[model samples]
Target: MAKIYLDPGHGGTDPGAVANGLQEKVLTLKIALKTRDILNRDYEGHSIRMSRTSDTTRSLSQRTNDANSWGADYFVSIHINAGGGTGYEDYIYNGSVSNNTITYRDKLHAEVMKQVDFRNRGKKRANFHVLRQSSMPAVLTENGFIDTTADANKLKSDAYLDRIALGHANGIAQALGLKRKSGSGGSGKQGYVEVITPSLWTYNTANWDDKAVIVNEGEVFTVARDKFKVGNGHMYQLKSGLYITASTQYVRYYTK
Candidate 1:
């Protein structure tokens, strides 16, 4: 499991950057909290620590020291960009630090850019205090331009922020080689396949066979086969795969 340190830039008396009614401190905190949630809930087993859980002020040195002292594998400082330009960008210190920093920063930039849909301001070298002083691999992300009305509006939405969180999680996952769990899929010798369409049914065979049992559409069952169809009328065939199903009435995609 990877240990991550998340720093939501600026708090308390300092709001970092502000424009279009969006405070950098507030936006940074929101994204940081959501990023922590995505890592803890979806990644599982990984550990995440935030620099500040609330609107408390901490200096850059204090934040970096905390992360280094805690033995964090990676450090991320989240901030909003301002001063005219719009879009996403990331920063790292000049010269080589460690392979981990380079790898993590590359993945982080890719993930955030994918979700933000802002100009790819590209990654550059900077002597930011957070990156310069941190013992672990660290990167500071400037999510978007608060000064731009278009970027500000995009940052205002919960869905947009969620995507940013997702990107952060994805970057961390990539760095740690963590595979994302498919919503309805599982893998193991004892894994089961769920039929969520038509009238719920489960098959327990390595392959979908004619003798697969028909449990209630909503019912969960262990499957022996990797492939099968859920209901009679549903044309969709579930390819051989593992699934995590729930206990409830199965909702058929089509009524027979």
Candidate 2:
């Protein structure tokens, strides 16, 4: 299992950067937490840890040390930049430019960039403390310039923060080749296709039984080993070992 350490830059007394109504510490923590949650909920085969789960202060040395001790495969430090610019940018240790860190950074940067309105500042390099000190591959991301008016307004929205978190989570998954772990039922695997219709019914039998569970809209699940045609519709096994609809009106996917 690959290990990833998320360090939400600055906390407690050290606010890091600030502007408008958003503080860098708070923003970073929010994004970092989201990233972790996404990785845990949607993917498998990862050991994820965080430097700080709350507003507790932590030093750079302490953060790196904790990750190092844990033998993390990757370290991601989340922060918001200052100095009146607007947009997103990411970094790796300067001297290790051509290494895997860049590959991971590039994937993450692209995922995040496509989802946000911030100006693309491009991937960069630096001698940041966490990058230079961490034994494993490390990156520090300046999500956006908190001091910029446009960027600050973007940060103020819950949706914007979700985009940032999604970008980072996708990057991590791409870098590690992590597989989808589950559907809405927490069955340890995601659905082959999303539930597009209002809802679909689970069957007690492949032939369509009298009573069954209701899988609602937006839920995903893996196709099962068994399938059968029931009237004008079809059914397949859910990852949960139950039967569900395989009809176009209920779900938008094909079983392998």
User: Least accurate stretch of 10 residues (summed lDDT) in model 2?
Assistant: 182-191
lDDT of each: 0.72, 0.79
Off by over 4 Å in 1: 179-256
Which stretches of model 2 miss by more than 4 angstroms?
184-256
- Residue 78 lDDT in candidate 1: 93
Q: At residue 239, what lDDT does model 2 achieve? A: 70
Q: Cα lDDT of model 2 overall?
A: 0.79
Residue-level lDDT of model 2, residues 222-246, one tens digit each, is 7655334455455667777777765
What TM-score does prediction 1 earn?
A: 0.71
lDDT of 2 at 52: 99
